[model samples]
Target: MKGFFSLPGERLFHVATLSALGFLLLFFVGIISSLATYTDWRQFFSILFSKEILFAIRLTLFTSTMATIISMVFAVPAAYAISKTNFRGKNIVDTILDLPIVISPIALGAALFVFFNTSLGRALEGNLMRFVFEVPGIVLAQFTIISALAVRLLKATFDSINPRYERVGRTLGYTKIKVFFKVTLPLARNGLIAASILTWARAVGEFGATVTVAGAMKMKTETLPIAIFLNLAQAEVERAIAVVFVLVAIAVIALVILRRFTSRRQTS
Candidate 1:
C-alpha cells in the first residue's frame, strides 16, 4: 500500500478519481432537484418544442456562431503576435485583451448602448444606428464579450507552442504567413477549436449585456437566454425552466468538447 501511494501515476489516479466523484455527486444532486420540481414532463417537452422556443434556439445558435467566427478571425493573429514577437506596448495590449473578462458584462453593454446611441455607434454605422435596438446590437454585445475570451484562450494556445518550430520554418524559407498556416495554426488547432466552442457558449448565455444593448424584442432579439429571462419575469416558470435546461445542456456540451480538445492537445 505504501509503494502504491508512492507512485506518481497512482497519486494522480487517486486525485482524478476523487475529483470525478465530487463532480458526479454535485451533478446528480442538481439533476434530482430540477427533476423533482417538474411534475409534467410531457407538458415541458411540448413547451420545449414550441415555435417560440425553436426560434430562440435557432437565433441563439446563429448569433453565437457569427460572434465566434468574428472572434476567431482576429484572435488567432493577435494571439500569434503576442506570443511570438516583442513589440512596444505588448504588455498593454495583452492587459487590454484580458480587461473584458473582469468587467461586468451588463455595465459594458450599457456603456456600449450609450456610445452607440450617441456618436460612436453612429460613426460606426454610417447610417445604421438602428443597430442599437436590433439584431446587430445583440451580435455586437455577444461579440464583445466572447472576443475577449477567444483572445485569452488563443493567446494561451500560442504561448504553449515553442518558437523553435517557427524558426525551423524560417530556416526553410517559409514566409511568416506560410509558417503560420502550415505549422503554427495546425499545432494550435485544438486550442482554437476549444476557444471557439467556449466563445460560442459564453455568447449564447450572455444576457445582461445583451438585454441592455439589444432591447429584447420577441422573435426579433430574443435569444435563448433572453427568452428564459423574459419567461421567468412574466411568471412562465415551466417554459423558463425548459429554456434553462436547454441552455445548461448546450453549456455542458460545449465544455465537454472544449475539454476533450484541450486534453488531446496536451497529450499530443
Candidate 2:
C-alpha cells in the first residue's frame, strides 16, 4: 500500500478520484433532498397517473417518436452521401447540416417564428407545410435540432465502416441499394439506434424551439421540458420538480437501453 501510494502518478490519481466522488456525492445529495422535500412518496408515485400529466407525457412521447423516425430517415441518406459519395459543395452541405448544433435553440425558434409569421407562413397555413406553431411544428423543431446530431453520428458511423465491404457485395452482382440495406445498414444498426435514442431523448426534453414554434398549448404542445418551465414560471415548484424527475428518469432509461444495445451489438 505504501509503495502504491508512493508512485509519482498516485497523487494525481487520488485527486481525480476524490473530485469525481465529491461531485457524485453532491449529485446524490441533491436528488435525495429534492425527492424528500415538497414531494410525498405517494404523490411522486401517483404523478404519472394524473390525467393531465399523462396526456402531456403521451403527446410528448408521440411527437418525439415521430420526429426521431423522420430525422433518422433523412439523416441516414444524407450521412451516407457525405461519407461515401463525392459531390460538389459537399463541405458546404456538411457544414450546413451541422450548423444547428452551434446555434442557440431559442434563436432557432425565433427564426422559425419569424418565418411562420410572414407570407410564407400564410401560404403554408392551409397547406401541409403549416408546421410553424402547431404540433407538427414541435416535431419539426425537434427534427431540426436532433437531425443535425443524428447526421453527425451517422456520418461518423458510416465512415468507420470500410467501403470495401460494399465493393465486395457489388462484385457478387448485388445492386447498390440491396448491398446497402443488406450489409451497410445492418453493420451500422447499433450506431444508428444509438443515434436515434439520443435524438429522441433530446427531443423529449427540448423546450426553447418547441415553445417558440409550438406555443406550449396545454395538452397539445406541452412536452415534459415545457411542462417543467411552465410550472416553474407559474411558481409550481413541486410540480416542476416532479416533471424534472420524470425527465431524469426517462433520460436514464434511454441511456441504459442504449448501452445495452451497444454492448450486445459489439459482442455479436
Candidate 3:
C-alpha cells in the first residue's frame, strides 16, 4: 500500500480514499444486486432470449451503431477544427456545439417533437421521410444527444497531440489533408476509438429522448432501455429484471473493450 500510494500524505489518506471508493462501488453494486430479487433464475435465459428482448437488443445495437458512425463523421472534423484552429467566434461556436450535451435528454426530445410540427419540419418530413415517432427519429435523437460528447472527447485527444508533428509533416512537402490522414489521425486513433465506444454505450442507454421522439412501440422502437420501460410499465417485473441484466451485460462488454483498447494503447 505504501508503494502504491506514494504522495505527500499519511497512510491514513490511503485508508480514507480507499474506504470512500469501496463505499461508492458497493452502493452501486448493491442497487444492481437487489434486482436479483425480482429476477427469476429459471426464466432468466428464456426471458432474455425471447423475441421482444432480442428485438430490443438488435434495435439498440443498430441505432447506437448508426448514430455513432454519423457522430464520428461529424465529430472528427469538428473536433479537429476546434482543437487545431483559432478563429473569431470560436468560443461561441464551441459553446453552441456543446449545448446538446448540457441540455437534458428529455428536453432535447421535446424539442425534436416540437420541430416536426413546424412548417419547415413538416415539409421536410412530407417531402423527405417521416421522423415523428419513427425508427429514424431514434437514431436522430441519440445522435443529437451524444455527438457533442464525442466532440469534447476527441477534442481533448487532438489537443494533447504535439503541433510539432504536424509542422514536421508539412516540412516534408505533405499537403494539409494528406498530413491529417497520415499523421494526425494515426495519433488520434485511441481517442477516436474511445469516443466511439462511449457514444455508442450512451446511445444504448438513452431512454428519455429516444422514448420521447421514437415512442416505445415494443418490437418497433423498443431499444433495450425502452424495453425496460415498457416492461416495467406493464408490471412485468421479472421481464424488466431480465432486460436490466442484458443492459448490464452490454455495458460491461463495452467497458471491457474500452479497457482493453486503453491498455493496448498505453503499452504500445
Candidate 4:
C-alpha cells in the first residue's frame, strides 16, 4: 500500500510521520503509566480480587462472548450476501446496516431502552423475554453496537477473496451452500477470526449503551466498564484505576493473540 501521493520532500515526510507515530505511542504509554502511579500495587491487587470486581470480570467476559457469537452468526451471512450478490436496494441496505456501527452506542442504548416501552417491546417482554435493564439487555446492547462492525470487517474479507474458487467448486457440481462451507469459509478463516476478536474487544469495552439499557446495578449489571464508571462516580479512583488496568491488560492480550495468529497464518 503505497502512499496516495509521492511528496517532493519524501525523506522529510517519512521522518515527520515516524515522529508522529512515536509521539502517539508515548502519549498512550504515559496515560497507562499514570494509571499505575495512581495507586499502590497492593491496593490494585486488592481491588482486582474483590468479589464485585470478579463478578464484573466474569459478566463482562460472558456478555462479550455471547455478543460476539451472535454478531458473527448474522454478520457472516450478511457480509457474504453483500459481497457476493448484487440486488436491488443493496446500497440502501448496506448503508442501513452501517448505522449501528456509526451511531453512538449511548444513543443506540437509549433507543433500545425506548423500544422496550413500545407495544411490541412490552409484548416481547411479557411473552418472550425481558431485555431492558437486565443482564440480557447487556448482551443485546453489545450485539447492537458490535454486529455492524463485524459485518463491515467480514464484508471487506469477502470482497478480497477471489470468487474463482467458488466458481470452480460450482463447475464440479457443488451447490452454492456446499461451495461456501467447503471452499469459501476455509479461505475466510483468518478474516472470521480477526473480526470475532475485534467485535469481542469492542463488546467488552462497551459502556454507554450497556449502562443505559442495563443500568448500573452493582453485582448484577456491573460489567468491568460499568464497574469502572461506578467507582469513578463515587470517587473510588484507585478502584477505577485497577479496572482500567484490567481493561488495558485485556486489550494487550487481545493484541498479542491477534498478532501471533496473523503471523502464524502468514508464515504457514
Candidate 5:
C-alpha cells in the first residue's frame, strides 16, 4: 500500500551509511595507532632529518610537480577534444588514453623499460632522452601513470561545461579558440584546480612504475615510497614508518588545501 515499506527502506539506508562511516573511522584509528607505536620522538626525528630521507622527499616533490605539469599540458587538449568531438575510433582513442589507469603501474613501467631497449627508444636515449634507470625515467613513469588519470578528470570537467555558452560566444563573433579561453576555461577553473591537486597527489605517491623504470638507488632514484620500501627491506621499520607518516602528512595537507580551495570557489 504505502510504497513498499518506505520507512523501513529509509532506516536501512541510514544504517548502511552509518556503518560505512564507522568503517572509515576505524581505518583512520588503525593508522593513528600504528604510527603511535613508533613514539620514539628522538629516533623519529633522526630518521626524518637524515640526508637520504631529505633527498628522497625533495626528489619526490620535484618529480611529482613536474609530472603533474606535463600531464596537464597534454590532458587539457586531449580532454577537450574528446569531450567536444565525435570522431572515427573515438571510443578506441578514449580507451587507449585510459589504458594507463586500467593497466598495472608495474606493467606500464616494464613496458617503458622494454621500449628503451628498442631501436627508436635507443636512438632517443642516445640523442634526446635517456629514460631507463635514470631521473628522467622517474618523471616519465610518473607522467605515464598520472596523465591518464588527469585526462579522465579533465574530460569530466569539460563535459560539465555547457555547449550553449560556447555557441553564444560564437554568435558574439568569438572564434572557438577565443571562446574556449575566454569562457569555458574560466568556467572550469575550479575543476582544473581539483584535477591538478588529484594528479599531483597521485604522482607523489606513485611507486611501482617509478621503481621499475628508475631503479631505486639510494639517494639517486629513491622517491619517498621507494625510500620506505628500501628501509623496510633492511628491517628499518621505524624509518619506514616515519616516511609513511611523512607521506600521510603530505596527503592530509594537500587534501585540506584542496577542500579549502573548493569551498572558497563554491562560496565565491
Candidate 6:
C-alpha cells in the first residue's frame, strides 16, 4: 500500500516537472517560429547588412564590453573585500551594493537624470564628459546597472573560494595584495570569466536605462534593443525581427561559451 502511494506521487512529480519544462520550451519555440516566418532571404540579408544595424552592432558591442571590463576592475576588489572582511555597517554596505538589482532600471536611469541637475552633478558634467543624451550616457547607464550584478556574481565567486589559501600565502610572507593576486584570483579565474560573460550580456540587453539616459537617437544612441523597439514602434516587423535574431544570436553565443567554460573548469 505504501509503495503504491509512493509510485503515484513520484509520477505526479515527474509530470509536473515535465509540464513546466514544456511551457519554457514552447515559449522559445514560438519566438523562433515567429522569426522564421520572415522567409524572404533577400529582405533578411538587406536588413542584416543595413548601416544603421551595423552601427548599432558596433556600439552595442563596444559599450557592453567597456561596461563589463570597467565593472570587473572595481568588482574584483570590492567582491574580495566584501567576502573576506568584516566591518561596521557591512549589511548596509551590502544592501547599497545591491540597490541597482533591487530597483528598476528605468527608475535608476531617471534617478541618474535627476542627479545631473544637482550642483555636484552639474559641476561634474561641466568639467567631465557630457552624459545626457550622449554616447557616454549609454556606457554610464550600462555600468550603473551592470556593475552591481558583476559585484554580486564576483562576491559569490570569492565566497566559494577557500580563505585558507590566502592565509597560507600570507604565512609564506606575502602581502594581502600579493596573496590575492597569486592565490585567490587564480582560483577565481573561471568565475571571473563567467561573470564577465554574464555582465556583457546584461549590458547588451539593457534597454530601459539606455533608452532613458541615452535617448534612442537612431544612428546615434541606438543599441540593438533600442533598435528593435524603434523598428517595432514604426511597424517595421521584418527589420525588428531581424534585429531580434541578432540579439538572440549574441545571447546564445555568450551562454554557450559560458557553459562550456564552466564545464571545463568543473572537470579540471
Over the full model, what C-alpha lDDT does candidate 6 score relative to the true structure?
0.92
* Predicted candidate 2 versus true structure: per-residue lDDT over 51-121, tens digit per residue: 76787788889999999999999999989999999999999998998789889998898888888778877
- State every prediction's TM-score relative to the real structure: 0.87, 0.89, 0.94, 0.94, 0.94, 0.96
Candidate 4 deviant stretches above 4 angstroms:
1-8, 264-268
lDDT-better candidate, 2 vs 4: 4
Q: Cα RMSD (Å) per model?
A: 4.0, 3.2, 3.3, 3.0, 1.8, 1.6
- Give the Cα error of residue 209 in candidate 5, in Å: 0.5
Quote the lDDT for 263 in model 5: 88
Mind sharing the TM-score for model 4?
A: 0.94
Each candidate's number of clashing pairs is 0, 0, 0, 0, 0, 0
Tens digit per residue, CA lDDT, model 1, 144-188 = 898888888988999988889988998999998899999899988
- Residue 84 error for model 5, in Å? 0.7
Instruction: Write down the lDDT of every candidate, Cα atoms only.
Output: 0.87, 0.86, 0.92, 0.92, 0.92, 0.92
Worst 10 residues of 4 by lDDT: 1-10
* Native-to-model Cα distance after best TM-score fit, residue 53 in candidate 2, in Å: 0.4
Q: Whose TM-score is higher: candidate 4's or candidate 5's?
A: 4
Two-way TM-score contest, 4 vs 6, winner: 6
How big is the RMSD of model 5? 1.8
Cα lDDT of model 4 by residue, 41-68, tens digit: 8777888899999999999999999999
Greater TM-score among 5 and 6 belongs to: 6
